[model samples]
Target: MKRVAILVETALASGRNILAGISQYIREHDDWSVFHPTGYMGATDIAGLVDWDGDGIIARISDPAILKNLKAKNTHIVDVLGNVQKSPFPLVKCDDRKIGRMVAEHFIGNGHRHFAFLGFSSERWSFERQEAFGQSLEKEHGQVSLCHLNPRHQGPAHWHRNLDHVASWVEGLPKPCAMLVASDQFGPLAMKACERSGISIPEEISIVGVDNDQSFCELCRPQLSSIEPNHTRVGYEAARLLDALITDERTSETLLETPPLSLYTRGSSDTMAVSDPALVKAMRFIRQEACNGISVDHVAESAGVSRSVLQRRFKDQLGRTVGDIILSVKLRRARDMLAFTKISIPEIAERSGFNYQEYLNYIFKKHLSTTPVRFREEAGR
Candidate 1:
């Protein structure tokens, strides 16, 4: 049997998901003797890792101590945690840049004209994510306000300081802005800051985070929306690469980036950044009920307004009529399904509230200037 050490933490969903993937690989191979610790990587575990003469190691390497210990190991090593930009070992981690771009597209699609990115300054992955997010958002929005919450002392005082700083930073930004936090761990911190600042979420501010840590996301007043990085795939790829290196099977020492799975929408970011409450209500109603072949009248009734009033509001606020908004929403849904799924064109039309495939083609040509198939092909690249 091959001895392998897993130095990833067990406290977070990301780490656990990586472990789950490793477990799956080991079960299939039945040759790995894993040396994973019981909880978070501590001093004792680090010592144990130093003592163990494993054939290979897969580690987050967030702590310098872990890196130092790992460097001393004369074995094949895979670093899953992307804390360093250039490292001695091959990296198997999430595509943080793509994650940022995805979240930026999400917020931009939801009509956010202003954006902010919050993250830790010490982490290379966090910085990379923030850079990609700012660049993507700034192309259309002109400028993205950036903030970094660096590591500080462990206490309630520092926590309160962070809250105050975030509250101040957010309060100064333009209203109806979307905030893309670096991770779910900071989601609640931002939410708490908003609570302190009395800024309503998804109205004055919409927040999206990375790593779909459900427990942290759900614990917030309005649940957080996050990008689900495929850590399981990362771990599997890591194991495959490590096995190749262990057996001297000609493995390349380079970084492998696993693309994110999907964005999990939640209460925190499931709204447009519009100021009009009536328009917001109408839009939400249409989004939830549009697939049922709802019309402008249905939208008006849902928002408790006359058709004419709703139309005027839509024109004034969004420069689009009620019918136009409904169609655009339908088109967006259809486009997302096309890019992400293998559903047929006819079924996609039916699901996206288009009555016929011919109509979907016509709309795509008119509004999107491309056929559904072509769009899917382009999106795949």
Candidate 2:
């Protein structure tokens, strides 16, 4: 049996999912035995485990000195997180750049030109997303205002402690701004600050985040819209690449990219491109009831407008028909259910207000450019 060493950091769901996938693979494979030198080792302690002679090392950290030591021994390293630098070993990374572009597009589509980025202090992924965001916005000749929240300053105390500082930043920002956070952890804090400051979500301010940690997203009031990084797929791919390296079937310096993340647009990022109050309310009602067998008539009645009037207003305000909007919301909700729940496809279809799976498929392909299972797989990861 081949022995493998695991070194990782704590407090991030991405890291946890990677480790879970690796452990599951180890248990199912007979030829592999694991040696965990320590649980969730930090960057400074990696050198002590360097001489273990394990077949490979899988971790989410990317320190230059640590990589130097590991490479000196010809150890195989897989970068599950997007922090590694140029290395001889294979690397697997989430497409943080694409995620940034997608979220920026979503915000811009909703007619938000004033932008802000709630970023972590010193992470490579943070920088990558921030760069992609700026590049994407520049295409429209627009600018993104940025804010960096130092987690250390927030301290380990109640996250609420940071609300005052965060609120001050929001008050200074221009209205109708779209913000993207570094991760799910910081996204909620930002939302809390917004709530405390009387800044309404998807109205006064719309926010997006990376790493769709559902528990955290749902836990926030109004729910959070986030970009789901395919962490599990990254983990699986890294393990397979590490296996290939350990078996001597592949050489060093291999690089692999996971598929782009499929975004989950919830209440937080739900808004129209137009500034019409009636149309915005109609859009919100459609979003809220879309997964419950909603129809054009239902939406029209709920919005207290005639079907013809609703259709005209929707097309004029949202650049789409009422039917199109309903289908879009239903399809998106179906995707969310498919991703976070173990429900069957047919059941998901019914619950998401679609009468048939084929209808679901048609709409999903039309908007998201992917199938339901593929979306779920990417989101689950």
Model 1, residue 73: what's the lDDT?
Answer: 83
lDDT of 2 by residue, 8-124 (tens): 654567766777767667666768877665443332257657557877878666567667776665676776665656655567878888888898889878888788988864778
- C-alpha TM-score for every candidate: 0.74, 0.72
Cα lDDT of candidate 1 equals: 0.83
Give the whole-model CA lDDT for all candidates, comma-separated: 0.83, 0.75
Query: Which residues of candidate 2, in runs, are more than 4 Å off?
Result: 37-53, 62-74, 82-89, 158-161, 274-315, 319-381
- lDDT at 182, model 2: 75
- The parts of candidate 1 lying over 4 Å away from their true place are 39-45, 152-157, 276-311, 314-381
Worst 10 residues of 1 by lDDT: 37-46
Quote the lDDT for 124 in model 1: 77
What lDDT does candidate 1 reach at residue 371?
A: 94
lDDT of 2 at 60: 65
Instruction: Quote model 1's TM-score.
Output: 0.74
Best by lDDT: 1
